[model samples]
Every structure is written in C-alpha cells, then in structure tokens.
Target: MSSPSDSTACDLYDADRPLNMRCACGRNHGRGAEIEVSPDDKLEASLMKALFPVDSVRRGFLRAVGANTARAAIASVLPLGTLQAMAQDKAPLEKTNLKIGFIPITCATPLIMAHPLGFYQKQGLNVEVVKTAGWALIRDKMLNKEYDATHFLSPMPLAISMGAGSNQVAMNVATIQNTNGQAITLANKHKDKRDPKMWKGMKFAVPFEYSMHNFLLRYYVAEAGLNPDTDIQIRVVPPPEMVANLRAGNIDGYLGPDPFNQRAVFEEIGFLHLLTRDLWNGHPCCAFGTSAEFIEKNPNTFAALVRSVLTASAMARDPKNRELVAKVIAPAQYLNQPETVISQVLTGKFADGLGNIRTVPDRADFDPIPWQSMAVWMLTQMKRWGYVKGDVNYRQIAEKVFLLTDAKKRMKELGQAAPEGAYPKFTIMGKVFDPAKPDDYVKSFAISKMA
Candidate 1:
C-alpha cells in the first residue's frame, strides 16, 4: 500500500507543504510561487480550472489544493498490487486484435519488435503494424481512428491535448516509445570547415514548424550566437524530403531521426551537425498515443498496450535482444535496412563517413524528469509563439498532456526504474532544469518568445 508521506519520485508532494498547498512542481505550477497573479497568470489558472475544476475531488479525497495538481498527485499513489490488478482484472480491451500505426522509422522499434517477438501477445494484445507517411499523416490517422494508436513524437499528443494543433478530440500518450534518436543534419554546402561564419546566411529545415526539432535547432543557433529566425532562415520540410531538399540546395540543414540522418551522411548529402542526444539528455522524443475516447472505451487494451511497449523496450535495451530487433525491423517497407544497419542503429552504433566505424552516444538512457519538464516547456512555447489561440491555461493543459500517473503505473508494471525525482530532471545546453520549477526553468532558457 502507498501512503501520502511516501517519498517516491513519482509522489507529487512531500510532507513539507501546507496540506492545502498544491504540488504544481512540473505541469501545474509556474516555477515557484507567483507572489502576485498577473493577468497572464490569472488566465493560466482559469484554463486549469476549466480542464480540472477546482471543486473536483481526486482519489476520493476532496482536493485540498489546486485541482489538476491534486488530480495528478492522487493518481500517482496507486499501489503496485492495484496496478497489476488493473492490468489483470480489467476486461480485455474492446479491440484486442489491434492494428497500430507507425511511421517507418527506427523509433518505432518497440512496436515493431514487440509485434513479431510476441511481446504484445504476452500482454494479451494482438497488434498489427501499420505504417504511415510521416508524423503529420500519422497524427491524422490516429485522429481519424484509422489507427488504434501510433508511435508519435511526444509533443504531438501534447499539442493535441492542449488544443494547440487541432480542435479534434484530445489524445494522450500512455508511454514513451523511444528517446534520443533524432539529429540535426547540415548540408555540406553549409558545412564550411574553414569558415564557421559562412552560416550567417543559410536556411535550415525542420520536420515541423513548431516542433522540438525546430526548438533544438533554434537553441543550437542561439548558442552559436546566431538569430534563429533572422540570422539563418529556418525552412519547414518533411523528414524524408530533408535529404533531397539538401541535395537540391533547397535548404541548408534539417533535424530528423536515425537512418535518414545516416542515409544523408552515407550519400554525402549533408554533414551530421549534432544528435538531439547531444543537446537534451534522454529527451522523450517519441511516444505511443491514442485518443481519450479510445482509452475510456477500452481501458483493458490500454494497459495491455502499455505492457507491450514496456516489454519491447526492455528487449531492445537488452543486448540479447539485438538480433531479434534486427529481424523484426527487416521488412523493406519498415526500417527496411540490412540486418547490419538495423543492428548498428538500434544498439547505438553508427557508420562514419570514413572506412572506420564507431558507436555514437546512446540518447535513450534518460531519466523521466526531462519528459515532464519538456511537456511543460512545450506548452510555454505554444503559448509564446501564438500556436495556441485565444485564452488557454498552459499549466492546466500540461497536466493532461503529461498523464504522469498512468506513466508511473505503466513503469511500475514494467519493473524498469527511473531516477529519484517525482519527474525526470536533466540539463539541456548547460542549463539545469527541475520540472518542480517549471516557470523558472522556462525563464532560464535563452529564448523567451513563448507567449
């Protein structure tokens, strides 16, 4: 059984706070105490109330604190036995023989490997792998119900949950798919080894306009002392078209995931500038998300689906499962690469342009605080950039996007351990961020354009 005083990092509050004080540490609070509620803060608080009404009780406890904060905190207190029971005792999902959608990329390894290796089956799921053109298309499919769920960029689901991207029904990320596989590739033309200043007039492409790939690129250019919007024109292009765009000199550089990053180097189209892993340690790059309706209608399937991801991720992380993943992702339509290529990328090895080869850093080995913090950070960006129209509370939406309680329950079932914080914490670009201090953390970043 769990107690309110327990110190699990997933525990939203400690014994130190006023009982009525909320744990807004990550998703709900804005950094620390806002001594005075500005118009913006008032608007943020109002939006929170709309999503999680102030009067709502959580876990049978009338909220003594902020509603959403209490809602999230109470959800995190589920006992391990109860979690296992939820997985075992719930009626099997309405749709067990599931056809899941994914873009053909290495990041979808968990779903691909899970399906063939019988991991989903072990969790009582019958999963069929469906491929999509890109993240945008995948989003549409997930929204249209063409897919039960799909491996998605973590921010996409959050974007939806907050009503940032589409007014369609909200979706939620049940678990992280894979992290740290994305990279920013620069065209060789912009790769002037002799003159670093030559990049003063270049266009860099990002897969989506308001995406982490774009955010990371902006941060990188800012760190290099260049204006992201003015110093270098940032172009928006699809991931598959990034290399071709580079080859055609349509854009100078772009950020994308593995294989595409590798293929660019292999074909001499661009120079790999930096992997996201180098920028944000263990950033939650992608996840498995489904609509709220799907979840409410089929809780049993949701638990099973989460269990499958856990098992598959464990296998992919384990050296013994390397051959298994290679075999699973071998279909030409999928990762569609040779066994050696799949092996190299999946286990963190990469092909150098030279005859020599080496293992690049593994970015997936990250704590969970980064995930929680980034959720809050993305919301800030959305508001700052006008991606979200009208009055919307950033903090309230962060709660729905994060779904920390569900993630914790799933993690507990997987037996995979996370860091000792209620949320994942890490430094990005040398700035230390604790989700507990979301507003301060957002302020710490050099870019303050998030409205």
Candidate 2:
C-alpha cells in the first residue's frame, strides 16, 4: 500500500492499524483515517465541506451558511507570538462554571459523557449536569438562562421557538444530541392486538399532548385508520410513571423514552409495540439548544459548545464507547439499571425475562438536518389539532424556531460534520428519507393540516 506521507496530495500520514490508524501528525486516530484530513488538525475548510464532497453545496442550504473564517484569517495577519498569547490567554465567557439541566435517560448520555470525558473542560467550559423533573421545567429554566442548556427533546426547541406553550424566544440547536431512544409501549392486555386495525378503541399516554410523541402516536393511529380525536384517547403522563401505569392498567399504552422502555420489558409490565423512531427513519429527535442571543454574543463560545457535543455524539455512536456510556447513564441517579443492562440497551441488544438475550436489529438513527423538518411537521400537527391559533404558517414557524444556519456556522468553525447534498430533507423513524417538496410532505400526512 502507498504510504500517506508519499506526497500523493492527501494531507494525512498513516500509522499502524492494530492500534488504530494514527496520524503521523501525532494526533491519536480512530476511524478518522478514512477522511482525508482530521477536523482536529485545524484545517482551513469548515468541517462540513471537508467530510462531505464540496459539490454538496449545490444540494443543501446548510452549505449556504458562510464560514466565519474572517477571524482566523485576521489572526493570520497578526504576529505569530501575538496569536499564540491570544490563544493561551483566551479566558472563558462569564458563563463558565454553569449548570445545565437534563432528564435522566440514555439519550442524555452525551451530556453525562462529556463531563467525565473532559469534553467540557477541553472547551474551556465548566458544566454541571442538573437533573430535572420534566420538559416544562427544562424549558422554563433554559429560557430564563437559569440553566445554560439542556439535553432536551428535539421538539422542545421548536415548541419554545414558536412560543407554543410560552413566549417566543430565538433558540439555537446546532448538534443533534441523541436519537432513537423513544418507544410506544402497550400494556400486556393489548399485546395480543398488536395490529392497530384489530383494535376499535384504545387509550394512550404521551408525556405531553402537544409533544412530538403525541404527533407520532397520532400518525401511527391514523395509519391504522384510527382517528386521534375520536377513535383513540391520548392522556398525558410522565415517562417514569408510564411503566407503573401500564402495569396497573390505568392506561392502555404509553409512548416513552428509554430505559423506561427497557424497564417495562425487564418488569414484564408492557410489550413495546414500536419504537418512536420507527415512525420516521433517521428523524431529528433531540439536540443541544441555546438562546439566539447566546449564538450572536459569543460565537466562539457557542462553537466550542457545539464542538464538545459533536465530539461526545461521535463517541456515543462508536461501538467502543459502550462501556463508558453505560457507566455514565446507568447510575442509580439516572437509569437505575445495571451497567450491563444499560450496555445492552445502548447496543440494541435485550434480555427477555427468561434469561434469553437477543440481538436487536439496527434501527434508524437521528440526523441533524431532519430537525428542521420535524419542527415543520409539528407545526402542521399543532394547527391540525387546534393547539395553536389558526393562520400560523408552519414554514415561517420552522424558520424562526430552528436555527439551522447558526448551527451550521458553529459546526464549520469547530470542524464538525454537517448535512450536505440537499437543503430539503426529512428523516422518518431514524432513516434519512426525503420528500420532493415541503408542501407535499405536509399534505401527505392525513392527521395534519396545510400551513
């Protein structure tokens, strides 16, 4: 094989493979050798164009978000020593040593992993992970800046952005935090009637009536020819209480996040009918969202935050990071399951009550770009359900709420990869599916209305 240092025009030098393809530039390498230049190398291009073909710009609007390279270019004009000192003395924003709220779940693993793994400290940020009771609290605290940010539901940002439950605030979501951890579970009584067509009437519990979970359930019920408003009843219940309610027969079914889904299985209280991710492949599920003001006032700080989450997300997606994530997410304060149990959940493996462990099939994972699509879809559903006022344009609501451009800019600065090769894309149930037109996408949904 040709050596990378042979000057073939690629900017990487190969090293031994058994220990991973380390870069000759002295940076520890993992699978990054597959890319021409590692983003950690401080290369000139934004992380998006580097990993994806530069031609992808024609395909997606994310590429339209310009790079803030003027700062770096301006720094290059300064004396070398001055640049070095500037880098060394870069004090963190007054926002350092802050608390960020999050609910306990496997999806919150990235935030938990970042702290002990040194991602936050590396970015010159000191973040305390505070556990909250519900999304409403997470939203309230984040809005007031009482908590810097949170491991929030993907819809939370859009909902807050549109002022769905409160005031309109410009929030920024740059990186998709985690995906595909949600499930729609049915009580044991309904397990035999797995096919929705066989059931005439059923009651479902969603964390909130207007959340993405609610819309997803409505969509699935609609697919089954059940009218959400008349055929099925959707009640609101916290995720942690879902398993108990299912066991006690208070609710017919529940849509919830894991390890609660895992807990139901372990306790033999409910059977998972389908994972929420199965509703739409590769959908935008959850992300790191902050205020619009935060992005403008502290671009560098915001970029660093994006980079930290990006790094954590990459690690979470890697198979080698299983034990690390399991240990972080399965504490008594978090999931309350054993690390081994959490490990199985992370790897998509499960143990039934009879001590039979099985490998679960690969499910569709979350992608960043789908976040905007999900927001738009939610807007349509809100209007359809009469949750929000009439005459609300979903497209306009999506643009105002989801800050794809701001996130793209930050991703480029930190060298994190971005969506390319199509501005209008949709992810349904963890699959990177696409629609020809936005108007057609909304019209295709029978349970939602046009913007």
Candidate 3:
C-alpha cells in the first residue's frame, strides 16, 4: 500500500489498480522517483490486505490518510518490529518444566513472586521456584545442573565463573533480581557500639563468601580503618539462621539479606544498623541467572525465563505493589517470614531496633539491569582481598559473566527503560569507582590485603 511521486506510476494489482510495470527502472515505483520496498513494506502490505481485502476499500482508506500517515497511525498502535518478533518467536521451548532454585530472602522477590503470579506460565514455562537452604547449596545445585536456573548473589556468578570459591563453571547473570535490599544488622546487646571502630574482634555473618554482603561489609569496616580479615570474624551463615545465630550470640551481627534484617528487629534480638544501600545506593544484591551452557542449550527457554522474571521485576518496582508482593512471597513456600517483617523490608517502613521507624522507600528495589561495572567492582574486591591472585582481566571477566547488554536488549524489547551501556560509574561510601580504572580503584583502598 503505497503511492509514488511520479504521476506515471500506477498502483499495484488487486481489485482497484492494475499492475502495468515489470522489473525495470519503473518497477514497484514511479518512472523516476523510487522508494525501496523492504520486508517491512511487504508485512505492512499483507496486514493491509488482511484488514481490507476489498481493494476499493483499501484504496479509499489510503487516499484519505496517505501511506505515510497510515503507516504512522498503525505503527503507533502496534510497532511492526514487536509484532513480527512475537509472530516469529513461537518456537517450542527446549526445556519447559524447570526447577529454579532460590534462597528464601526478599532479594529474590521477583523470582519468587513470578511463580505465584503465573508470570512463568504466561511464557509457557512451568517453573518451580524452589526454596533453597543457602547460597552454597544454590551454587552446588547449579554446578550439578540439579536446578535449571536459580537466584544468585550478584557476585556469586562472577566468583563461581572465576573458580574463586568453587570449581570453574561458566555462568551468566541474566538480570539483577533485587538491589539495595541487604543490610548490616547488629545484636541488640551491641546497639551502643554503632561505630565500626568499636566493632574490632566482633563476629559477623554473611550469607556467602562470594556475596555483596561480604564485599560491602569488608568495604564498610575497611573504610573505618579496621581490616575485615584480621579485626573481624566474618562467618558464612545461612540467611535463615542469621537471626537465630544473633539470638544465640553465635555471631554479634551480620551483613545479610532481608527479611532477616527485619526479622532480627522483629524478634527483638537485633537492630538494623545501616542498610547496604547506605554504603552504595542502587547496589545490586542478588541476581537471577543460569549457566552459560543452559542459556546456549535452551535459548528459547532461557529467554522465556528472563521474560517472566523481568515481568515480575517490573511489577515489584512499583511501591504501590510492595505490600502485595510481600503477601505473595511471604507464604511458607517462599520467604517463610512474618508478613509484618516482610512488609517492613519490602515497604521500607520498619522499626530500626532503637525505637525509630525509618521510612526510606528506595530501601529495596528490583533493578534488573546486571551492570557489568558491578561485576568489575566485585572483581576488584576479590583481587584486593587475596580471594583471587595474579593478574585479573576485569573487563573480560565482567562482560562474560554479567550479561548486561543482553539484559538491556531484553529490557528494551519488554518496553522497559534500558539504561545506557554496562560500565556506568558507581559511588560507594563517598568514593567514586571508575570501572575503566578498576586496578587503580583497588590500589587506592587503604586496608586491602593486596600484595
């Protein structure tokens, strides 16, 4: 459905206008002026025919609005590229029924809620969002392919991929499940010792060694002139047991995921000292991903899984939906926490264990972008703390493990705002981290274990 500039050009054949030209300078165009007929053009033509099979009606419609205007109107209603992609992406999933592991924490809000909300089913994927015991088990299961996909600490994938704490298995973080949802909680007995300088020789628990909890805690105390390695005891305590450990005096405090932070406050055993977001706003805590092998072998299924989680992430981002999400994911099958504690964590209105209800709405967020720069920062920390030795290819490892570009592309396709590329700078504890100068950034730290 088009009109040519030259009066000599006759319309294409159907019922109204008969074809007059064959393959030549005039073919599918005016005698002199021409417009390229693209595949999009063919698609539009077919859609036009379907809409108005009677050629006279189609001709009248085009005459009234003109081809350019008509195209603009239709495209505004339904983008042609999106429509074509939807039509073409109906491939059978290589693996439909899948088990996706998750630690029962609010950091996994999107992945956990996707199951109850049927977002996975919408993509024709039957997903079981299994409540996992801890982060190490999540890693082991992923390594064994016992779980098709799982919730991961944002740094876990990078660590696992580099063989930092486990055997090397190539992993890819598809999307950050949640951000700014972790906190440093302290035993109520030590509430007077809010200063990190006073925390010397104190025992602390982190969900995993390869976690933002560990990195951020190290960074926090390190900035306070306390070497996290020698001055503090950082234990790998499972999140579910963090509150119990705090209650039993097994650990003095923890930099851990919620609703455990809120759980400790609710149980009167601990108080929230500072949210990790205070250390670095919009910092990624947990990620949703599968191995690179899984993604390659089950591209369609992986895409479906990503689409489902992203849909849930969008839903969870709205503050209005936080309470609903808390309710949805608070059942015994998911986070297994009290609704009030989960609500406090998700809605950001909670007792700080010192007689104050803090209302910081961005306290937790579902920012799905797995920024590669975050990976770069994690790598720098690994090197700084002697977790990884020798020369490290920060950018190469970051780009391979954190699928930021793919996340952005998928976000764009999902009609979400895909922020510009991967390596945006981050401000942590008043220090600017330039991803391009990761080595310098690490060396700049005063209390690192770097040789």
TM-score of each: 0.73, 0.73, 0.81
Instruction: Give the lDDT of residue 69 in candidate 3.
Output: 73
* Tens-digit lDDT track of model 3 for 1-451: 3444423343332233532223334346543433323333444443444335455676687778775676565444323444345435567899999999999999899898777655675567778878889888999999999999999998888888989889999999999999898899999999789999999999999998888999999999998999999999999999999999999999999999999999988898989899988999999989999999999999988888887788779878988778767777877888878889999988989899999989999999998988889999999998999999999999999999988877777777677788787799999999999999998998897898973
Question: Candidate 2 at 106: error in angstroms?
Answer: 1.7
For 297-409, candidate 1 gives per-residue lDDT tens digits of 98878878876676567656755445546655766656666666566666666664433466764733322222555676666555544466555554566677666677677
Return the clash pairs for model 3, or none. Answer: none
The TM-score of candidate 2 is: 0.73
* Model 2 lDDT per residue over 266-339, tens place: 78877777766567655455677778777677766766666666656765676654554676566565566766
RMSD of each: 19.6, 12.9, 14.1
Error at 71, model 1, angstroms = 48
Candidate 3 lDDT at 186 equals 95
Judge candidate 1 against the unseen true structure and give its global Cα lDDT, from 0 to 1: 0.62
Query: Which parts of model 3 are misplaced by more than 4 Å?
Result: 1-89
| Error in Å for residue 393 of model 2 | 3.9
Candidates sorted by TM-score, best first = 3, 1, 2
For candidate 1, which ten residues in a row score worst on lDDT? 12-21
